[model samples]
Target: MSKKEVETTGHSWDGIEELNNPLPRWWLLVWYACILWGIAYTVAMPAWPGIKSATAGVLGWSTRAEVAEKIASFEEMNAAVNAELAAADVTMIKPGSDVHSYGVNMGAAVFRANCSQCHGSGAAGNFGYPNLLDNDWLWGGTIDEVAYTIQHGVRNETDEARYSEMPKFGADELLTDEEIDQAVAFAMSLSDPEGDGTNLVGGTYDVELAAAGAEVFEYNCASCHGEDGTGDIYQGAPDLTDAIWLYGGDHDTVYDTVFNARFGVMPAWGQRLTQAEVNAAALYVHQLGGGQ
Candidate 1:
């Protein structure tokens, strides 16, 4: 028997003839399989967009529900520890105790989630933010103090917030430009014992200008900053004696602070976080080696 000849397409290019060929059975089967799979997938999972939300598939699974369930599990696991932290007195929790350790761990998480945005991941602080790892606290560094500050915040709008207003000597016309310069010199002298008013390099003190500036400081700044420039924590006056500065410690920076003043604000965590979270954050900060 002779084999049947395949027919050529009606159109041809040059001398070449084209044959219309059917798709491979295997290829067609695969294409059909894909279509069926897509239909099944649409039925089994959320695939269509709706006016308010996505379509609820037969499986009824939701990413939000999954996240909620995980959060529930985490809360369940930490319920007892969180309860203890909420109830325990922040001052009485000794450093090496289990509760203290737990607070430190949990507080670290809280700090990362919330405080890290301002204080940095390691709490080293940015230019305006205060460092947490050091012994220089604008407010008192005691555990109770730390807790109180965290709860009520500093310069926040809350009634119980730690509030202080640094008078802008230049802007407010409280001090002449020359007097402000003298005040800056005196403030610098407090931190730099050997610094002369002429140069910041540590050396023999500039007795003459320092003496002059001291009078200026005593007359204007001593009310809140203390006669010795040790700063009154109760008044939120930053200690000038320490070289550590929330703003820069350089002469220009000091002049700006004296002239314009600084009023940094911290939000009241008590309004945002639960009592246990607040206590944990306080404990974590207190244990960071700066707490008094």
Candidate 2:
């Protein structure tokens, strides 16, 4: 075929002619189709941002609705087990039963999602958090007690939450510096009956100081902590004679605690989780060898 001469637009720059060639018909058709599709998509699905909220498309599609539907489906799948768990007494749930197995599995998931951050993934706990694996318990350790604690929480906003407040003897000036020192000496002596008194917890003490502190403890802390510092479950007091310490047993730490006080807060799971979930978590935690 002979070469055809191409026309140019009536415009030039630096003596170069500008071709007046139109785009290929197929390409033009596809471009127009894309524009139409985009307009349809904008009308059928959410696209524009409004002042307060996004424009609701004609199709009524929503990400929130989709997520809700997914959650509903999952809930439906577990509905039977959840209902059974909610009604059954956790103390009576046999270890080898189907409900028990399901509850323990579900509880593991719940603990990982909600309790892991504070109690650790293994539930071993941290310096300030109570170890769930040990026999030591600030409150009671039975499955029923565990469920109650989870339901009400500790030192939280809920009306039924477990409440206890340690008096800041140092901060409130209830005890003189010397008397506070003596009281700390007495507390240390409770934990270590055979160790040297002067070298306990990187601090020094004397027999006379401990004797004086013993009297002070009897007068002040005996109400909640018990006469021997063994603690009272009713008062939510930790056993002072044990090696377990929530914060630390160091002299400075104990002094600061006596001066200021300690308050730990836990949210009421009953408010956030279903009764089944609460029971499941309690059952799982209670069987971890810590529950009484």
Estimate TM-scores for all models: 0.86, 0.84
Encode model 1's per-residue lDDT on 100-125: one tens digit a residue.
99899989999999899999998998
Q: What is the C-alpha RMSD of each candidate to the true structure, in Å?
A: 3.4, 3.6
In terms of lDDT, model 2 sits at: 0.87
Estimate the TM-score for candidate 2.
0.84
Give candidate 2 regions above 4 Å deviation.
1-31, 157-159, 197-208
Q: Residue 119 error for model 2, in Å? A: 2.1
Error of 1 at 40 (Å): 3.6
